[model samples]
Target: MKKKIILIAVFVIAVAASVYLYAMYKPHRDITAETADFTVSVKQLQEEYAKNDTMFNKKYMDKTIEVKGVVSTIDDAENGIVIDEKLSVTFNDSTKKEIAVGKSIKIKGRLLTYDDILEEFKMDQASVIK
Candidate 1:
């Protein structure tokens, strides 16, 4: 009877530990080497998301994407650069580039979200196309 009880306690502890680990686990996504779910111009992306946000989110959320646009602003801002004043592509510190305003460029990034008030799309973990 004592052995049975001890076995049950151990089983319970094991299950609880497994549950905790599963809860804490967050797998990272590698954008490189993966085909982009969508390749779009910054202006088109902004317009699509603005017109039908729910559909846009369903298609682009948490996915790697490539965007082509002319840089409208670049500075020390943490919010990334504006694309024709319609979108912002914030770069990760490690992947940041020395890009100038008015330069045509393509960038790869994870589509984070859209801001309605600003009428802008935001990307995170962005890297400039070489």
Candidate 2:
């Protein structure tokens, strides 16, 4: 009985460790390949978040979304862009050179956070759609 119990316990431990390792090593979601959950302009998303942040946060948080606006600023060091002075998006492709200031473009990314003090929305793993 003692040997049987010891064997079962060892089996359980091995299974648990395997499960944990698999989960930890699993690849992250590719946001660029995934479809956007919502599509809105920079103005609309910023206004909605400003009005009721908690409600919108529950709705938009951690979800992939697409936003359209003109590029207001480009940070080459960060490989990112601010749209309409309200949304900040960091692109996955550091070599992307299609964007320019004052040019209208569409981008898809996962909504990361809303900075109420700055009144801006931040996204990551972004890709240019237009």
Candidate 3:
């Protein structure tokens, strides 16, 4: 009985370790290759969130999305751009170029959160589509 219990415990331990290692070593998500769950203009996103914060949060939070708007600010430090003064987008790759203020553009990313204090939406792992 003792030997049987010891064998079972060893098997369990090895299985758990294997599972953990597999999870830890999993490949990172390729956000650029993912299809956007929802595509909307910045104004539309802001209005939906403003109308019902909890509802919009449940709908959008952490989901991949594409947004369209005119660029209002570009922060090289953050490696992102503010769209229409409401949505802040952070690019995963820094080599993107041709961005300019007042230019309309489209970006695909995951909707991270909405900052109530800043009255802006936050997204990351973005890439400019246009």
Candidate 4:
């Protein structure tokens, strides 16, 4: 019947679209080895994000960002490191570094979010840029 055929076609299209979206949003298979989408300095990045939180969030969210700045603190307390007291980057749990406070370093990771109350931008699943 034509009606039955039309229903089957719609179902097929719906399944195909679901498959496409799942593939697109799935986490990278090799996140540690993933390349960064943007490279920027701590001060400049923070200023831009602060000025326009929603726009910056949309642009950078879920994308790898490489941020270069002096280490403000290494937070073993949490999951990552804080740079210049503004940008926080979280690497894989197994990753380690001997970075010291005030040492300049670059980190590459997926951007998580920017916190207005803390006035800090956060990143996750990150690695130190050598």
Q: Which one is best on lDDT?
A: 3
Model 4's alpha-carbon lDDT is 0.80
Tens-place lDDT per residue, model 3, 1-130, is: 9999999999999999999999999998888999999999988998898899899989999899999899999999989999999999999978347799998898899999989899999999999895
Whichever of 1 and 3 has more lDDT, that candidate is 3
List clashing residue pairs in candidate 2. Answer: none
RMSD each, Å = 2.7, 1.8, 1.7, 3.5
- Candidate 1 per-residue C-alpha lDDT over 1-130 given as tens digits, one digit per residue, 9 for 90 to 100: 9999999999999999999998789666666656788899876776777798899899987889998888888756574787777767777664435677898888888988888688678787777777
Q: How accurate is candidate 2 locally (lDDT)?
A: 0.90
Select the stronger candidate by TM-score from 2 and 4. 2
Compose the digit string of candidate 2's lDDT tens values, residues 34-105: 999999998788678879988999989899998999999999999999999989889898835788899999
Regions of candidate 2 where Cα sits further than 4 Å from its true position: none
lDDT (Cα, 0-100) at 74 in candidate 1: 77
Q: TM-scores of the models, in the given order? A: 0.78, 0.86, 0.88, 0.72
TM-score of the candidate numbered 3? 0.88
User: What C-alpha lDDT values do all the predictions have?
Assistant: 0.80, 0.90, 0.91, 0.80
* Residue range with the least summed lDDT across 10 consecutive positions in model 3: 91-100
